[model samples]
Target chain A: MKVANEQTTRDRIIETARQLFLTRGFAGTGIAAILKEAGVRSGSLYYFFKSKDELLVAVLDQYKGLLRPILIDPVEAATNDPIGRVFALLESYRGFLLETGCRMGCPIGNLALEISDTHDEARDRVRENFDAWCACVEGWLVDAGDRLPNDLDRAELARFVLTVMEGAQMQAKANKKIKAYEASITQLRHYFEMLESRAK
Target chain B: MKVANEQTTRDRIIETARQLFLTRGFAGTGIAAILKEAGVRSGSLYYFFKSKDELLVAVLDQYKGLLRPILIDPVEAATNDPIGRVFALLESYRGFLLETGCRMGCPIGNLALEISDTHDEARDRVRENFDAWCACVEGWLVDAGDRLPNDLDRAELARFVLTVMEGAQMQAKANKKIKAYEASITQLRHYFEMLESRAK
Candidate 1:
């Protein structure tokens, strides 16, 4: 029972910090804010996380764990066509922008740009998140098979998709509009059409 | 001469803040660090700018001012072909990544993601930077004219280019390698080729 309570406290702290960090950014968010928002004392926070940086690591780990269930699975289930799945994944992001009024972006991407230069462990975790994202898209491209050009490098294309997604989110957030996001995705869709047309 | 000296001090502070903010992020950098690095006192900093946020506006304005000479002119001078100029502009960013070992990304992009949620003034400035960048590329796409399909929406394609550049930089910085950057450019190049081949 004690262990269960401890686990709940840890999870609560991580979840609260995740939301705070996502909206406020790692450097912009402070420990006091997290403790206050999480409804925890300083002792409880330090008990679970030795420092705020440690808490960041926990949040990242939680993000990694949630990627499949929270992010990929829902989108993947919405579309069965391999190429369509690729785009459905992007649409999920567009949905996020709409829901947040273009205020929130990809949590990992937000941190990737903000903390990459300062935090090694957090940076590596960000990289892993990116790699995992790319790998999922790559699988779709590979499954796309001859519908995409036979010579098409699936891995590189996946990276491009990731780039488009991240870049689109940045523009959308900056302008506080979905137009930039829509425009980029439209261009990406055009590129994919060209690729498919050139298929073997 | 006294006025000129004051102008020099202001420039120095803005320049130092620019570099620090680029590498460290706006939220991550403090006024003390900027004052120490720029060799200016608090009195001088406060005299010129009321707060750190004000300093950030000045830094953003400095970036906006330098866009023509430092960013666009060199690339424009290097290429007469409109399409080549677009690639050349991307190449300049590649050079930055290589020189900085991928530690720094687009200063405007970093700020766009970091400050868009909290700082309205900073967010607007970042949006202006993106608009300015997109306008330059849109000009090139316009100049390319019939060489690209007439059906191509030049404005949207320009946005995609910005997306690719910002996204590429994010990936490069996260991975601390140029491979992701190179891969995205290559995909963008391939997309361009398809558009040109389908030219009117």
Candidate 2:
């Protein structure tokens, strides 16, 4: 009973809504579906969040917290090399796509296009999530030091990695095939080699 | 008036729906709004299309018709060099971001994430749209001939360009800024240079 307290209940709801939004999209997901999946009644959900949009904000906020702990740390632990870590981060997403059969894309990216204009609060949060993601990638590039060309804009390159991932994921899911995702990443790999070669 | 024929009414409805779906998203848009925007009554809309989904299919069909004429042809007119045309295609999207202040993204891309999963008909259409786009870019790469590395996967490179554009647009729209898109395209330009230099 102690484990199923207010905070846990609220977290459970947010997690459920986040998954639904990623797979089904914000507009397509119904409140009843969230309630059903979270195993909470309407009253319980209403207690924690005023509306579905608030739950979305909470989900996005949770994403900010999860990025480092969930996605980055595990990949970082697997590889100490900064450049390897970047690809490892991308591969982690590949693993998810494989598991889901390329059905879901980057959560933040999914919401970014689906509701960014209609939902202002969520839009800023989406931008924050993106900023945080690019920052992580940029930090790795900074750590790479002499490995990459000095003239290379690390921030821009980092964002490019993100762009590649989001775009690849969209294509993969749309085509229902992993090959589409692979093609994009393979080109990115070549681009990285060219950057490293120029540095040398 | 001869101008208001059945075909014109149908095309007008599709054009209005395409704009709304791109700007507002598939799930967020309602039939009434499409009718209002198209300046047609519900009877006329239903006369041309039986359901909202049918209208969406019509919009997607029109998209296939519009891509070559609206996007690629104009960009091709600007440059004879195949490589220049690739960047020109990307720059055209940048122009769109600039005009709309980074609001709407790639039309097919927006629908890909929004309705592709929920609507199978739309999903296939989205995939075909992506395939057609990639084929166009691939044709340009083939036209580039020995200018690029012989070993380079031109089909993969073509898809990568699409990935970069779609991803850059999504980021630009979410950030409500054009610089995000510019950063991605700039990085892509660098990648192109690397490929060309390697060939030389």
Candidate 3:
């Protein structure tokens, strides 16, 4: 009973922090704000997370886990054809962005933008997340049977795909237009098909 | 002489505010901090702008003006070949990101991420700045002759290019690797050339 209840409090603290962090961000969110929102006392908050930074990392880990299915699964499923898969990945992003009214810009992108200069650990985690994501992208390209530019390499293509999605999401969010994302993915698909044809 | 001094104070306040806003963000930055950095009093800050939001708009306008030549010039000059010009634009961006050490993200992107649901005016300005940038991209595609996909319009192509670049910048900033931006632009360029060949 003790372990179960302890776990519940910890989880509760983490969930509250995650929501506040996403809505407010690292530098902008205060512990008092989070404590008030969570209906937890300061002692309880400190019991779960020793510091705000630690709490943030937990928030990011939770966020990453939640976002994977929504962001990566659809693209990964299109593994049979890398080009189509890339487009599908982008479309999945579009669907999410449109659904959310273009709010909650890419979480990784958001953290990176906020913490890269100040927090080395948080910054590195953001980089690792992006690299892991790129590795997934590279897998899609490799499965495509080397149709992409040999000179270009999978790492480069991964960067390209990642860039388009992040940029499109921001633009779409800013403009409140699904078309911005559609435009990016459309060009990306066309770009990929071109390389595939050239290789053939 | 009085007008000149007044203009100097206003410019100083704006310049200081711009740096703080980019580094600390909208909510993270306070009027007191801006005044301190500008070496002015609270009363002086209020004299120039009615509120922080007004000051923010001014800062953004200033940023847009500053970015035009540095960000847009090379892309425009690369106009000799529309497809080539677009690639050049991406390359210029890579150079810009590397120079910044991937710390300060796209100012517009930063604002969009930080503003949340408030400051619709600031959000709209960011959108217009993005659209202006995209317009430059579309103009390049227009110059590409029949290189772009016939089915898709220039506006669509431009929007895609914008997303890729923005996304690439965001990812590269997160990863702290110049290579991330390079990979994205190269693939996008390859995609553009493929479209040209298909048109032939």
Best by lDDT: 1
Mark the 10 consecutive residues where model 3 chain A has the least summed lDDT.
Answer: A1-10
Question: Quality of candidate 3's docking, in CAPRI categories?
Answer: medium
Point to the candidate with the largest TM-score: 1
Q: What is the lDDT of residue A2 in candidate 3?
A: 71
Q: Write the per-residue lDDT of candidate 3 for residues A77-149, one digit (tens) a residue.
A: 6556666776776667666676778776576776677777677777777877777777777777787776765
Docking class of 2: high
Give the alpha-carbon lDDT of every model.
Answer: 0.92, 0.90, 0.75
Which pairs of residues clash in candidate 1, taking residues 3 or more apart in a chain or in different chains?
A: none
Q: After superposition, how far is residue B79 of candidate 2 from its true place, in Å?
A: 1.1
Q: Report fnat, model 3.
A: 0.77
| Stretches of model 1 off by over 4 angstroms after superposition | A1-7, B1-7
| Residue B61 in model 2: lDDT | 87
Q: Report the candidate with higher DockQ, 1 versus 2.
A: 1
Worst 10 residues of 3 chain B by lDDT: B1-10
List iRMS for all predictions.
0.6, 0.7, 1.8
Instruction: For model 2, state the Cα shift of residue B151 in Å.
Output: 0.8
Descending-lDDT candidate ranking: 1, 2, 3
lDDT string, candidate 1, B39-111, tens digits:
9899998998988888898899888988989989998898889999999999999999999999986889988
Q: Write the per-residue lDDT of candidate 3 for residues B1-200, one digit (tens) a residue.
A: 37535568889998999899877777778888988888999988898799999998898888778766877775666557767777777777677687788766477777876664457888888887887877877777777766655676888878887777777777766767776777777677677656666787
